[model samples]
Target: MECAAKGLAGEPCAGVAQRRCGSCGAVAYCSKDHQFVHWRFHKEECARLATQMSRIDVLSQFPFTFSVEPLALNHTLPSMRCLFLESIKVHLKGLWKPECICGPEIASVKDLSITAEWNMESSLCPCTEPENPVTRPLASWEDYYQWRSLPLHSPVAVLLHWPLTLYHCLQLSRIQTSRHDGHATLNIHYLGPEKELLQLAVFAELLALFPGVHLRIELVGPAVPRSRDGEVVNISSYAHCSVQNCGCRSSTAPEDLNSSAVTLKLWKGLYHERYSDIAKDSNPHLVLAPNAGVAAYPSWMPTIEMIREIGIPAIFTDFCEEAAHLASCCISYITGQPLGVPIQINPFRQPIAENNSALYIPCYSNCFVFGM
Candidate 1:
């Protein structure tokens, strides 16, 4: 009997299951799409079923041996992906829980997909800091790519000019999926004072989706007055954090109608250390390193070895492209592949070490998973 796999977006594929996985007939899928979506999820199951169906130790005799990491026995993955992350084992000390990286939550996927606005072959100059950085408008990817090609020096320049890329990445992570518990936590290194306005909008929309909210923020840029040890400010106390100024559609508010429930653990200086200490209370699922080096916190960059150890996917806006390498490593670890031409990169930079792995989306995204 053919093994008809169930599709995540819709109905089960029962059409004469023609594609056979591995040697035995125990696991089969009716279509390539069905097969792709089910692999990481079913790989372990396949091994068990294979033994019952055959006498040949199929995997044992094979040239490849994969030492799998321990996944949640609960199977509460955050997103639905075909090829999930698998890796060699390493350990770290953190109370954080793993989250599934997912695609855009907008009703229309077509709205977010890469558009043909730039020829992509056009010349780009080295990126530099804008004379006035705060009010810089976001650029389309084509223009961003074109500018990044120039002999760019500052990571700050990339952050100033490329808010759209960062915004899309935020959307792609779908970073705010609330658990059934009605609470969720996320971490974003506030890129700058102006960017805080945007972050407020993003967080407001995210918080409105759930009843109770726990926000952990690491503030950067010239916006917040610097304190050496950092400060914890309740966002509700800030006038700009109000629902009206936040520009969100969510109607949920505190009983008083004036106080926001959001909390901001704002800080600066030695972010990785500060962030780690802060994480003890509310473990954040994602980190926003949009600028990468300076405000994005480059010293905090972990080697590919460390990333495989943690088993968490990262979203990068390291306009300088270093974060891309780290992200590429995350993708490679999952697929057991070597780095190559990434699906995308800023113009005029060497490819990051982690390139061309299963972690990549076909265009303009890393760690993308589409679930119905």
Candidate 2:
């Protein structure tokens, strides 16, 4: 870790940071002098970080088998990604490589032939709901896992964060489900999709989660493949599980399947660039951007302005608390209003932590969520 303190010339101190902040443990300093120099600025977020650190156990809870493994025992394992890769017997070389200081980007693993186990079917579709379908909001991963009858060994956590985060955003917006002939419809404009485009099928889990709701998600992003632009994928049924005797396979009858439970429309380019065309068709109930570095990207300004003018409930998630805090400030400045939903730790944040964070802060995909 590098020192968090600034030098006399207003540059970063070129000192090896070995001392951690006692209260929060979220940052480090090169020496006592540097620590004292950085205290004025660090004091503001120290308590908040302490509170987050206090809840580390809760934040780290996940159903994956890796969660129970002895990650802490491997002193040589640099980060969670290394442990995961090691567990899968994949070396951090050749086809598999680290993507950033955050660690290897799970999205870069595109060889389905090799990642078959990790890319297991959602097994959510064609399922029999519990005697009474869940109507109340799900508050945690454990709640969703129990409700869905998911095994603790399941590896879905790697990809389920996409839909789960969306579900959490809807809950934050308080968008009530209205039934019409025993079915509900939810329109969502999912902005800034990147790797999600390749794993769209995972989103079919939304059908099972929402039960009777038909989800129409418009994916708008620059990462959208040009050839796939304007393509509409209607997922009528959930992806089949590899397990032959799975409950969903046996319990669901052929006639019970809906024609289309989730419809994904792909649009190329930035949301603001094509939002006018998108709005012409249907107004979204909520706008969601997962891991959106709002303050870091200048492109988000137009979208923020449009969202403010249109007055739609928009939610954004970031990898760290500092990013979320900056994003919240950016939105507040753009909208000229207080946040509709204040910054908070997302209960459904990705279980794996990003190591090598400069601040030593706990960072994860969809770590902190806020809205304007």
Which of the numbered candidates is closest to the native, going by highest TM-score? Answer: 2
Off by over 4 Å in 2: 5-15, 30-52, 62-65, 68-79, 85-132, 177-183, 244-260
TM-score of each: 0.33, 0.77
CA lDDT of each prediction against the hidden true structure? 0.36, 0.72
Per-model RMSD to reference: 22.1, 5.0
Model 2 lDDT tens row, 1-372: 767785632656657788999999988887788888889888998998787667667667665665523355735776556666566443343222431233334345443121122223435322334444676788987787777777666545655788889998998999976554466778899998875665666676686678767788999988777767787887644444446665544544335334337778889999999998988875799999998999999999999999998988899999888788889888889888989899998988877776644677677889889998
lDDT of 1 by residue, 217-242 (tens): 55544333443124454432211211
Off by over 4 Å in 1: 1-167, 174-214, 220-228, 236-253, 256-261, 294-308, 320-372
